[model samples]
Target: MRNRAPRSRPLRAVFAALTLVAGTMFGLAVSAPAHALGNGLALTPQMGWNDWNAFGCNVSEALVKQTADIIVSSGMKDAGYQYVNIDDCWMTGSRDGGGNLVPDPAKFPDGISGTAAYVHGKGLKLGIYESAGTATCAGYPGSLNHEQADANSFAAWGVDYLKYDNCNNQGISAQTRYTAMRNALANTGRPIVYSLCNWGQESVWTWGAGVGNSWRTTGDISANYTSMLSIFHSNVSLAQYAGPGGWNDPDMLEVGNGMSFTEDRSELSLWAEMAAPLISGTDLRSATPATLSLYTNKDVVAVDQDSLGKQGTEIASAGGADVLAKPLANGDVAVVLFNENASAQTISTTASAIGISSASSYTLNNLWSHVLTSTTGTISASVPGHGSVMYRVSHGSGSSTGTTHPLIGASSNRCLDVSNGSTTPGTQLEIWDCNGGSNQAYTLTAAGELRTLNGTLCLDANGQGTTAGTKVITWNCNGQSNQKWNVNPDGSISGAQSGLCLDVTGGNVPAGNVNGTLIELWGCNGGANQQWRLG
Candidate 1:
């Protein structure tokens, strides 16, 4: 939400001398029950432009208007990027005498209503911002004690979305505070997309769906490769907490900012696969054709807008290669093969292993290339380092059925071979040449658990380590949180404990083949050490 943009706010007493720094917004009214409010605003992740990441407190009506115009004239509006959000710094230094928030006339001389009208005329919606706390992050007035007046003001202004941030919030229940805004929005008799920006405090994912249309699952996103990938890894595992209407936001897009071309593609592709919001955080008024093209890539957009709201699951991760699978309503599955390693990688997985239908053959359509091919239940690709490839696969007319097999590594060309034939808790996992050993066989259950079918043990993130480079081991099944796992659509398996991904220690060619190099948890760096191919 910032150039170091402040996060959304929390409820608290107003502060003195409110400094100014802008955050973000999308709609005015209407709401969701963590179930995306069933209100029909962001049925798919909301696509729009947010100002915080680009301009911060420098936001002005002129900039917003020009941005909205560019969104339409550049074909972004036609491509479904319709919301023109005004993040922070749009409010006056003080509210009106009626205790209502006021727009700063110096910045918005025609006022919010005029801006809203102008945006709506272009077939776009207007969004406003407020903090749950007494002050927004930059010290601007917040909604802590003025939820109703604020909501009323926004509705009257024809605001279509509301980005509620949490800053300056005195210690209070996030549930209670966020619910206050939720109820307030509902009372307005208008449809607003409620976005909760609590920065993951209180595991917002757990209760956010019942309150807001989308909840930020991470901290702010910077315009760089590491920050973007870091957020992606953090949010992907929380997919289960989101459903129709409610989404888990991984922060805004950084595609047009500063990352490499390949990295930008990976960013866009991964966000689409995850079903997260696609709010642009760039200077759209000066965007290049390449930037606009990346924003409007039809194939990527289609998979993201697919009616099926299910977020993709990470099917496999080892040595920096991951596969995430999103089931589409069209009986097709959208798969993204991502290589997070420094070098290019050739990864593969079977339709059945990734949770697609067990049909004998699958017809593959490259979403990026539009290339069509028929596979007999197997999908493979050579993904560039730090880049990704996406495809839509449907059941083919061929007669082969899907099969289950061991996960094989690319660099080592070894199976997810176990260190020993033991099924006890604490058994070490390693990559060894394929031998069809019973130990090498594992199952990714619908419950998001990777288990030894015959052994009855679940893969566990040792000690529930949340930091990068934790140890992963086997444990007896217990319904505890740490034992749960998520197969992200990026081909990485993230544990429920810390949401850190599975990694191959010293993940290199020959060293990775050694029986026990300590397969551990690590920050998902997209290295080959975290990649695996399901046979």
Candidate 2:
């Protein structure tokens, strides 16, 4: 859930002392480089089973044990699925006398430690959830100010992964609250993979790598094509922010949650293509053969677990047809042709467009059909609606052409301007009448920066700000994260530093189309103000 108003909690004397010591010891402004936490966890997107989508608050010790047993027996363990996570409501509504979370006796008779041991015995890790607020989404006692005590409790319980959620956060900056937990987890001397669940607000991806192993890039996903497609579009653009030890999570896999079989396959394919964490949110004990097959497809799972850790790029997207290509470690590329229409559509792209070099011929290995075919250069497929076709291409060749184009706002139909056509650094960006001037022509480079002014000035976030409404300016090309941009498939461009959209200021208003509307970074709301097209 997104940030909500936190409930008032009466501070106990003992908990106060503990909080004071924690704040003094681990609170001296925790910061890290733009890389991951560097604890050597989550080198690739995490593969696991989480219980929120299928079971909700109905989790119990028996259910968790049975799921772990089934994962091993059903070949999922061999296919790379590991963690078995318990979601919210695992604890009682209140804390104990020591200000520690207490597992519900009815649900976890042997406590969380017992469950963790049982899962560990099966050669799998255990995960648990907690909110960063005074109360969880289900109204259970949360870790808000008690982050230290809670971290200790989880470590003592042998927990291997932590899913920290956003609920009743009291409007605190996500950076401050999440950083506290990251510090607390480090203090415990245990290796716990932290997963940030802030629903993508505050551009978490901009700094999530320095804090946690994975961060959600959108709102929760439902089991339908529309929700999946929307989340996919939101996440597919943030590829530059994802790599080893950190990822852009698009929420869990809703494979068996009532979507059609084709839609389920597409969800898995797109998630794999995006290098997203593959946490199955379904009841494994009752999963059908097809659902299990979708979860345990070694070929598709290999694409997700590829060592290159490069998130797929959108080669071409038009109408309801989309093409995505992810480069693998072995000089091979994984390609997907997806159709989002109501019927069937043919999608096509060349090997060169996907960053492959020319060769005598290209070998295409169909991931789903397990069939082999040869292509001289073009990769095309007639895909069913709500379905996808994925392939592993080997020994292919292609080249990319660089082009500069004008970025037009979807709402105002104006050009992105450099504010008086200044060449100086820190000249704030704006929207003006589209005259096709050099100021409006920006070239998106393979390194992910948007360069203009004859490739001298790159689009940058002023002061390296990671919050919404930050000034968007032009700076000298420096190859920094603040200057990187992701041109998304939904006609929106987002900053690699902030993960926020390049929005026309006040563009949601009636007078937003004036000749000189300033542009800034803001939360992506799917509004016309945040949408842009390049041509």
Give the C-alpha lDDT of model 1: 0.76
Query: Candidate 2 overall Cα lDDT vs. reference?
Result: 0.84
lDDT of 1 by residue, 254-341 (tens): 8778776568778999999999988999998776544665686677898888788988888899987999999999788999999988
Return the TM-score for each candidate structure.
0.69, 0.69
Model 1 TM-score on a 0 to 1 scale: 0.69
lDDT per residue for candidate 2 within 389-468, as digits (tens), equals: 89889984322114677877756667899987899999999988889788998887889888998888999999999899
Query: Candidate 2: minimum summed lDDT over ten consecutive residues — where?
Result: 5-14
| lDDT score, candidate 1, position 272 | 93
What lDDT would each prediction earn against the true structure? 0.76, 0.84
Model 2 RMSD in Å is 21.2
